[model samples]
Target: MKIAVFTWNLQVYNHKKAVLSKHVVEHIMRALFGHAATGMPFIGTLLEIKAPRRKDTRPYSEESIEKIVKALQDEFQSHEFKIIPRIKAIDCGGLPNTREWILVIYSGFSDVSIESLGFRKKIAHLIKAENLKAILKAGQRTYRPRQTYHTHGLADIMPNKNHFEKMDTFRIDLKKDPMKTAKEASRQSKLLHQGDAFDEDGDLPLLKQFRGETTGIYTSDGSDYSLNIEAIKKRGTKIANQDENWYRDGCLIKAKAVDSKGEYRISVVSIHLPGPNHTARDGNILNTFKVVGFRSNPDILIGDLNTHTEVIRELYRDLSTELSTGTTLKFNSAIDFGKTKYDRAILRTTSIWKHHSIAITAAEEISSRPGKIQPIRYERVSDHGMLTVVLHDGGS
Candidate 1:
């Protein structure tokens, strides 16, 4: 079987693209899931969701910008937009209210039931659940002109005949693995196909949400097997245990999956180790994750580890022994990583599959696409380019 391991850090586009948090999504979905003429094989995407900013600084003065940047950096925190009675544009006066700020969400998709024609859905129900009324009810009418929230009915996510609720999605959160206690996890693979019986509000809200760094695992819509984040652990104590209610990051998502071939293992980790102590913590996280994958006898390990200079060099050296160090193409970030450096991903070797024909999409290619341009933000959809690894699970 051919599978694509794709990892991208969508710095959480902060502009009109993130307004409805809709159109920007469609563009990305279309890229990987759009080709109907040719069916896409299994793909695992480690999407590091972009984050929401407290406010866009484009319209502010140099003095104010310096102060805000200093305050966030000094305190070691990223600000999220607060609930405003009426969210207004940051268009300082004569500035035509064009720019918008948004957040980076960590979400993934695979094994979608109704993705054959494409992954299109009306998401009005979703909007209400997330309580994004500020974005939907901004000013004269709706902040997002294209939002499919029917003018007459509930938001379209589960709108009518084509509703996600009816599709029987097999979702299981690793934090509460329903099958781990079983004698053998693989034996309980059938559980993934069961209907949506759990209370969405209670059981799986955090797992199945469009929030920050929430790793997702969607099994192939046609496959008989299913995958779940069977376990989760924090690598960096500080990064994982931050006090902020809105911020969530630094996690190792160890998954147990059963396919037609049988039970196997893999991992999706997002390590956000920042500040002066980043390099050491980053190493700790990577080393720990690799050891686990090896013990589990896995397929692949996909996700981000916010690595910088020394950490990047060390990661490649450490994984060289077991994992295939495929081609790594790093892209530049607007937030200067000491000038030229950018975010990158590197996949190590495992037992279940062989890596081949690996490639990274050109930054220019994705960056070139035209959209509602924001002077300082929109040019870069994501600071990091996507890394794709082709894996052959059969006779290599």
Candidate 2:
């Protein structure tokens, strides 16, 4: 089984706001959560102190908090899910005299390959409830407590919190900082390029001319699962899979690879659409899937598509009617403490669904906010967990 983990928006800061350091902290937290099956490691975190120290910003009344905790415990016990570790934090965001907390409850299959992992569905449903309750209660606080979860940002929960209040929005000086500007510009430029390439003359390069001294391009390309962006660009005329006008969170990454049936393909698009932007993004997804080249031949379209709505069924129906083949992206990161809904990762082919084993696997949300009153030592991470799946070689 093949799996991929996706995390977004990991912002770590210090009390002075000037001491913002997210790189080391983010990596540490990811390493901890990424390798949790081994053992609980004391992840290192920098401590900050101030004239006014971190205070408990939990908004829930004691009575209400107990009720919520009881509810979560009752649901967890009733569902038979094993309890994972939960961490709380006192101060985050580098805000002086401010207190915050984030609690992450990790649980997953001891062995990922077991078919019984589907039972995690029950746990996912319960965990989401717990998260939702926390979101609601935290929203009621005097100050909107920062979230340490994957997707449940203060914007997602409160929706009305001042966006300026987000501490990570510091205007990074790019002009005076030539290295930073060059790096970001180069990164964006690479992302704008839409093919694969190799350093040597063999394969293809995604971005043609901007090849030398570009450091992060390789990492970015590999992150999108491209072997060599330069190599793919050399293979064929890189064409936009869909309209250039439509700008969504995902991109159109295409390559030519042999199909399962042994036919060389013209174009393959790897997309990563945001989970929340369904209506417009779904239309783009359907349109791209229905394009002429993708419809007729051996091409693979795969990525994190945040759409798991009726739109998916509609796409299935349309593809079925056209005699084309497609499957909804499968991977569930839903835990019991929050709303449990699986984001999608779809792979489409000319063949029907029955011919292949498309296993959509669920992983636990590794990013979380420490609970209020607990000292925050780790980084503030994204709330959405990762979803990885494998399409076996023989599956149609």
Give the number of the best model, judged by TM-score.
1
Clash totals for all candidate models: 24, 60
Candidate 1 TM-score to native: 0.36
Query: Which 10 consecutive residues of model 2 have the lowest summed lDDT?
Result: 111-120
List candidate 1 stretches off by more than 4 Å. Answer: 14-37, 50-277, 280-297, 308-350, 363-377
Please write out the lDDT profile of model 1 over residues 247-315, one tens digit for every residue.
Answer: 223333343334566643444333322322443443433444344323333244444444434233322
Q: Predicted candidate 1: what Cα RMSD to the true structure?
A: 21.0
lDDT of 2 by residue, 1-396 (tens): 111222222122223222222332333334334433333212111111112221322343223334433443444343322223222122222121222111112222121111111112222222222222222222221222212111212212322333323211212333255345434443332232233212243222322223342211111212211123344344532222211212222223222223335532222223333234443433434444334214323223333334444223223321212211222212332332233232333344442321222222222334433546874443222233323222233333
Task: In model 1, state the lDDT of residue 388.
Answer: 54
Candidate 2, superposed: residue stretches over 4 Å from native: 1-246, 252-268, 274-298, 308-342, 349-381
RMSD to the true structure for each prediction, in A, is 21.0, 23.3
Q: Model 1's lDDT to the true fold?
A: 0.31
Assess each prediction's global lDDT (C-alpha) against the native. Answer: 0.31, 0.27
